[model samples]
Target: MTHVVGESCIGCKYTDCVAVCPVECFHEGPNFLVIDPEVCIDCGVCVAECPVEAVYDEKMLPAEQGEYVELNARLAKQWPLIVQSTEPLPEADTWAEKQDKREHLMEMS
Candidate 1:
């Protein structure tokens, strides 16, 4: 199983999870981060590191957020790798607790 970055990470884009990933599976986008399923070790370290609770194991993902599994996998290959923690997007705190953020997800880094 691999960890998926879901809708909650859309506009928030917190990098805390990236900081703890041992396998460097994280990829950075304009307003989100994704996990490269092929590289993820499934260690679950990123789940707790996400302040917005955006990361989840494949089996643990909410039914409504199921699309994120493929989203993360697809986007990871298109975005650049993120091996270190970095400042979140401006107003990240304001968006962190907001729900239904899938529409806000950006496609570019």
Candidate 2:
């Protein structure tokens, strides 16, 4: 199973998870990141690396965040690959505490 990046990552866009991904499955977007389900090795290392707990195994994804499974797959194709850790958004700390930020998700890198 692949790990999914959920709405919690919408504004925060932390790259901690990306650095730990051995398969370079993570994709970079303007305000978020997504896992390429087809490339993910399902190692689970990236899950704990996410400070906002945004990454989850597909099967363990919350019911309410179920859409992220497909979202991750779709977005991964459009976004650029991110294999290194980088600074998060300017308001990452503030955004990390907020929930339901799906509406803030940006589609561009």
In the range 1-109, model 1's lDDT, one tens digit per residue, is: 8889989998888999988888999999999999999999999989998999999999999999999999999999999999999999999999987888888888876
Q: Please list the C-alpha lDDT of all candidates, in the order they appear.
A: 0.91, 0.92
Name the runs in model 2 displaced over 4 angstroms: none
Residue 106 CA displacement from its true place in model 2, Å: 1.0
Quote each prediction's TM-score.
Answer: 0.97, 0.97
- Candidate 2 per-residue lDDT over residues 41-102, each given as its tens digit: 89999999899999999999999999899889999999999989999999999999998888
Per-candidate clashes, comma-separated: 0, 0
Error of 2 at 92 (Å): 0.2
Task: Give the C-alpha miss distance for residue 60 in model 1, angstroms.
Answer: 0.6
